[model samples]
Target: MRCHKLVAYSVSAAAMVTLVAAGDAWEIKSQNKLVKHCANREGYDVCNIVLDISDTHALCSVCRLNRTIPDLAKPENRLRWSKLEQAKRRLLIGLMDLHLPLEAPVRGYSRGLCFDFLEDQRSNSDVAQKFITTGHRDGVITINILEADDVQRVWQREHVGERYRTLLGHMRHEVGHYYFELIVSDREGFGQIFGDVDTAYEKALKNYYARGPLPGWEQSHISAYASAHPAEDWAECFAHYLHMADTLETATAHRLIEQFSEQGDFEQLLLLWDRFSASLNEVNRSLGLSDAYPFVITPIVKNKLRFIHSAIARYVGLQL
Candidate 1:
């Protein structure tokens, strides 16, 4: 059995995270502290543990979106949720850094976002479903806590014949679906590149599962699963764009590359990603690990990425 220490904190007019049992008088106070006693607020034992903590800042904005968390009665579930939160923080931070939309939808629109880290029958027999799929709907991204388990995640990846899969990859892919709803709306060049967007998702996915993605899926889609549907194609491309953006930013931050920019030159970004990913793959090989990036970005996939790049530029600034 595991136990957590409870701490009370208050930050006037900003936010406060009161660590206590749910349904308590102070439930839903702020964030992060909901799981642990670290509210990032002053006067708490854990306050100022990191340079990021300050009196002006209380519960982090990222932890505020969590609608549900795993059952902490099991020690492994806590670690799994920790992994999920880490990846989720990276995802939300990356999107916010790009000046993209992060607000959870207020009314019938994708203006905001939320997350639900849930478990199903696989982890608990009393749960509702046998499996919990990682997906996005109406601005809520649901991730199965099992995805945090490396052994299980790796089994699923190979069973599904995926070339690349990771906790961050799943977050990027699902958020791509969320952003697709926000970014593409009767926009020009979408259909020209991603093909029809009106295909019935259920039927299309049913066929995709039964027969698998079409042959030569590599020539056009970013991954075999991207060929499952037009929507998925857009999501895969969007995820790749995010990978490029985040990795490029990291490379620069670490001084791995002196020249990197997210402005104006999409072509230049592509060139940088090609070289960086190549070096990254080589480094993995030196470590006797698999390639960091296994798939090649074909011309069609590049066009889709280009469309996403332009959409993001428009999203960030009203650029043409």
Candidate 2:
């Protein structure tokens, strides 16, 4: 995951027209014999399956959120964009399953979302003259195209000392920041639960990089990066909450576990997650890969996740 520095800016009103037109191209259509079947590319068939089932002439809802895709004139950019879209669809599907809102800012919803898949000089110097960092601002999330490359992502993981990192993880983490603005920033007692987000962000970030996390930071923070700022702590915890929710949902869908209700008791969800994550790790080991989830959830972290669940339940009108 890249460093997230919140920038204050609203979506341009003028862009709404173009975004709406793009979204309309993906509307579900009745299957008909006249419809031309789309071909799946490189075994990445989520978008193709969506088109096939719906008989739509455009990409899926998740793919339609792409306001800006990387330049496809470059051969490698197409594959990278494809990989990014796959991870993005997974995130969107999970959000939908959880009954969270999926409106785009262009759709007249204040909390609407969009994506900008960009590349920096590191990936294509001829096309990108400036650096591109992954972050979320207003309603738009930006992801660096290099993250889609397995070799580049692995190098970043080692350089950052992260036990696990993936393009999906990046999306989940950045969206956490966006939701904090929508769900928590204005709520009463927000500071009390997640600390003060109104603190000087740039200075805090500078200091965090200068001296690193405080001693025994893991006792309270979910990750070393989370200790950098209160906002980061909330985002990291929120990301972890999504990790658990989506993975549990996938496991249930695959019948690896009996059907379980996410809207049920929060404690029960955590218990199931404890068992499921352990099994997931064992499965990864059997395949000679690292643990699927590499961080321990201390008691404090659990409390943070519960807070997230409560917030999400509130947003979705659930009793959990």
Candidate 3:
């Protein structure tokens, strides 16, 4: 579905006060507000508010989807969970901005989404699990809490030979898998764009690990990992699409672009992204940091991303 452009809201203190009539409305307030406030786990003041409901301390919609969180008895786990929540919230914000459905799995919808934030033995020796791979199954996305640790994530990124790795990237990529089941699994022509998913996943992954990505993989895939299988390709492409859409929306909101419309000319958006991403990389380089986005969009990858856009358009009931 075509994403709706967010309407800017200008809320002055007076306007806020007016909306808080009878204290029945939600009002963005300072964290220091000792009365009562529903603050998002992510440190976003915009999402922090004073709810007028009886259960004013209730978790926000995004936080409520977390099926399990790491044990808080361990002080470090709290910080790790917070980092994961920050990334998850960003992913949810992107989906919500696009007007996509986001029901919890407990709602009984087959496509309902949920998350399990866990820590493996690597992070918590008390855990029985020796390892936990970040993945999606059914409607649940399991993320290893260790991904939130900067040193650990960088070490793993280097070990896996990844140009970029991040908790947000992991969340985006896994949600891509979840949406594949939601939007593309039973759709016609899915195979034509992403190739046959009927291929045995275990065998394909084993072979991919043995051989790595094919030589000249960039000509067709967005990342070497995307060449692992048809499903992986689709998920990777979908992740990139989310990255582009969210980044562009943020840039537009910051007035980096004069105007932006997700449903506007697709090619035009790509062109604008090319210029913006290049400048973004240059800015990062100026700071002696790695490129924010390390992959190039070849024609084949662009087609895959276009397919993702079309699927999202259909999912949101947008007439494209």
Write one digit per residue (lDDT tens) for candidate 2, span 1-320.
15442111111111111111123233222222122123432134424333333444445445567789888788888789888877886787677767766674422246578999988788887864588889988778999999999998999989877777899989999988877765652455667666788889999999988898867978888888888888888888888988888888878878998866767779989999999999989999999998999889989888888888888777768423
The residue pairs found clashing in candidate 2 are none
Models 1 onward score TM values of 0.82, 0.81, 0.84
Pairs clashing in candidate 3?
1-312, 1-313
Clashes of each: 5, 0, 2
- lDDT agreement of model 3 with the native: 0.75
Ranking of all candidate structures by their TM-score, best first: 3, 1, 2
Residue range 97-184, candidate 1, lDDT tens digits: 6778778543356447888898989988888889889999988889998999999999999999998889999999998988887677
Q: What lDDT does each candidate get?
A: 0.76, 0.73, 0.75
**Lowest lDDT 10-residue stretch of candidate 3:** 6-15
Off by over 4 Å in 1: 1-58, 105-111
Clashes of 2: 0
Top-scoring candidate (TM-score): 3
Error of 1 at 61 (Å): 0.8
Pairing residues by index, what is the TM-score of model 1?
0.82
lDDT (Cα, 0-100) at 74 in candidate 2: 89
Report the candidate with higher lDDT, 1 versus 2.
1
